[model samples]
Target: MFRFAVLLLALLFAAPAATQSLQAQYEAFLEGTIWPQAKLAGVSRKTFDGAMGAKRLNTDIPGLVTPGAKEPPRRMRQAEFSAPAKYFNERNIGYITATGRSLARKYASTLASIEKTYGVPARILLAIWGRESGFGRVDIPHDAFQVLGTKAFMSTRPELFRRELINALVIVQLGHASPSAMRSSWAGAMGQPQFLPSSYLQYAVDFDGNGHPDIWNSVPDTLASIAAYLKASGWVPGRDWGFEVTVPASVSCALEGPDRGKRISDWAKLGIRRVSGKPFPEHEARAEGFLLMPAGRHGPAFIATPNFYVIKEYNESDLYALFVGHAGDRIQWGDSRFSAGWDRTDSMLRSDIAKMQRALEGKGYDVGGADGLPGFKTRRSIGDWQEKNGRTPTCWPSNALISAIR
Candidate 1:
C-alpha cells in the first residue's frame, strides 16, 4: 500500500507530456513563428539567424508558466496592494529630485535643444530620464532579442511579446542598433527610456544628428527620445500636469475618473482649491480638468489635466505620473510635498478585493474587470455601493468594506 501511494505521488507530480523539451520547443518556435515574422518585417536572414541562432530562452522571467501547463489561478491571493503613502517615500523622491537637479545642469544644453524641438519641458524630460534609468547610471542587462524572444515563446502574453520580438528584429535589420548593443529589461523594454521596440521605432530621435537614435549611449538621444514619446502621446505645451488640491466634503469622492471631467473653473466653484493657495492658471480655467483621487478621499487629491493623462500614457499608474510631475516640480521649482496626508486604511488581500469587485460587477457596477487593483472604477463603485446601502461613501477600499460586501 505504501509503495502504491509513493508511485501515485510521483505520477501526480510528473512533468507534462511533450513531444519536444523546452529547449527544442524554443528552437522550433524561433524557426516556425519568429523567422516568418522577422521575414515579413523585412529582416534579412543573416541578421535574424545571427541574433537568434545560439540564444537560449530566459525561462526565469517573472509571470511565465510552462507552455502546456495548467493555467494558474486568476487571483493573486498573496498580493498586497501597497500603501499609497509608501509610494511617495520622501527618501526615494528626494534622491530622484536631487539627482535630477544635477543632471539638469549637466545636460542643460541637450535638454534645452530637446525641449525646443519637442515642445516638452526640460525639467519634465529630465525627471523622466532620472526616473527611468537613473540618468543612464543603471545598467540594462538583458539582450533584447533574447528577452523578447523568450517571452514570445512562453510568457503569459505570448502574442504581445511576439510582436515586440519582430519589431526588435526590424530594429536590427534597419541598423538602428546591433543585436549585442540591444540590452533590455527582463520584460523586454530597452535602453535609457525603457521603450518597447515598437515605441523605439516610432519615437526615438537622432537628436545629435548621428543618423541613428542611439538611446543606449547618447545623452542627447535618450533625452530627445523621451520627449518625442511624450510629444507623440499628446503632451500639451505650457500646461501643468496637475495641482494637489483639497476636495471639500460636499464634492463626492466618487466623482473621480477621466470620464468625469469638468472645467477647472467648474471644479473651483465646487470648492476644490489648490493646496498651494494659488489659483488655477487663467488658460486652464476653461480647459477640462479631471478629478484624480488616487486613494479616493483617504489620501492626497489633484485636479489633473489632459497633460496629466498624457504622462500616464508613459506609465499607466497614477502614482508613476505623480512621481514624474512631483519630481519635475522639485527640480524646476523647489523641494515640495503633497499638502494633504494619506490616511491609514485597513489592508486586504487582492483576492478579497477581486471578490468584492466581481460582486459589484454582478450587480451591474463597473469595477473594471474585477482585477485585484482598486482603480478609479473600483473606488467609485465602492462609494456608489456605500451610498446605496445608506453608508457614508469613503470611495476607497478597506477590510471592513470587503467583509460587508461579502
Candidate 2:
C-alpha cells in the first residue's frame, strides 16, 4: 500500500515535469527553426515575436505526431468508406439553400458586382459562402498562431504547417490583420471562405472598399475572396458547373475522369441524356464535358464541365463540388433533389480499400498511391480490371471485388 501511494505521487509529478520539458523544447523550436525561416520570408522579428509569444503546443490537434514517440498505426483501418448520401443531408441542404436565397436578396448589389467583376455567378458564390462557414454564422474559434505553431512544430505534415505559420506571421507584418483579430478553424483555415494563410495572402480581397481584407466579419470580403479564388482556379465565364445525367448502359463507367473529357455534343450522340429531360444547352454543346460518377453506378452521375473541376479546386472531393453545385441550383431555383437516389452498399474499411489499391498497383494499375480513398484513378482502375476479367464494371470497391483483386 505504501509503495503504491509513492508510485502514484511520482507519476503525478513526473507528468507535469515531462510536459514542461516538451513545452521548453517547443519554445526553442520556435526560436531556432521557425524564426530563421520566418525572417527569410520577410516577416519582421517584432511581428513574429508578437504572434508567437505565449503560444503553446496544442497537443489535441488532429493528425499530430509527438516529438519522439512512435506514431501509432493510422486509424484508417477502423474507418468505413461508406456511401456519400449523408454528405447531402436534406435538413442541412434545406437550411443552406433557404439561407443562401435570403442572403442573395440581402446582398443583391454586392453579389451582382462580384459576379460581373469575377465572372462567377452570385448563386455559386453564395453556395460556397454558406458551405464554408454557414454564410459566416459558424464559429471559427481557434487562434491562427497556436494552431499553425503546434502543427508546424510537431504534426505529421510539419513542412506544410511551417510554411503556413510563416505566411501567418507575414499576414500580421503586412498590417493586414492583427494577431488577436486572426481567428481560424482547427486546421488554420482563416475566416468565412476557410482559406489557409497562403490562400489568404494570394486570394483574399478588400471588396467593400474597407482597405483591408477582413474575411471574418465582412460579408463582401468573404464572398469576393471566394470568387477571386475560383476565378484564379480557372472558373469559365458563363459556364454552368455540371448537369446530372443518365449515362446509358453502353457507356462504360471506366470512361469517367477529367482526362477522358468529350465534347458535350459528342456525349449527347453517345446516348447520355439530361436527367431533367432537357437538351444540353446550345452554348454548352461545343464545350468539353467530363464524366463524373461519384458513387460508381450506385448514385447520381454528371456531365461535368471544366467549371466543375474549377469548383473542385476549392475543395478536391467530387461530393463537395456536387453539393455546392446542387445547393446553388436549389438556392436559385427552389428546392429540388437529385434525380437518382444513392443506392445502399456494403460498408468497407479504408484499410481493405488500401489492400485492393495495392493489389491493383501490383497488376500495373496506377491507383494513385494507395491512399485508401477511391479517387478517380482507383475507380477507373477497378472498372478496367473488372472489364479485363470478364465481369461487369461497377467502378467501386466491394467485398467481392477486394477478394477477386487479391
Count the clashes in each prediction. 0, 0
Global lDDT of model 2:
0.91
Model 1: residue 140 alpha-carbon error in angstroms? 1.1
lDDT of 1: 0.87
Task: Output the worst ten-in-a-row residue range by lDDT, candidate 2.
Answer: 72-81
Residue 369's C-alpha lDDT in candidate 1?
A: 81
User: TM-scores, in order shown?
Assistant: 0.93, 0.97
| Model 2 lDDT per residue over 1-406, tens place | 9999999999999999999998999999999999999999998888988999889988888887887555555645321257688888899999999999999999999999999999999999999998999999999989999999998888878889999999999999999999998999889999999999999999999999978899999999999999999999999999999999999989999999999999999999999999999999999999999999988888899999999899999998888898999999999999999999988776777878889999999999988888778888899999999999999888988888898898
Model 2 stretches astray by more than 4 angstroms: 68-71, 77-80
Evaluated at residue 186, the lDDT of candidate 2 is 87
Clashing pairs in 1: none
Q: After superposition, how far is residue 35 of candidate 1 from its true place, in Å?
A: 0.6
Q: State each model's CA lDDT, in order.
A: 0.87, 0.91
Per-residue lDDT over 155-175 for candidate 1, one digit per residue giving the tens place of the 0 to 100 score: 888889999999998999999
User: In model 1, what is the error at residue 206, expressed in angstroms?
Assistant: 0.6
List candidate 1 segments past 4 Å from native.
Answer: 1-20, 68-71, 74-80
The all-Cα superposition gives candidate 1 an RMSD in Å to the true structure of: 2.9
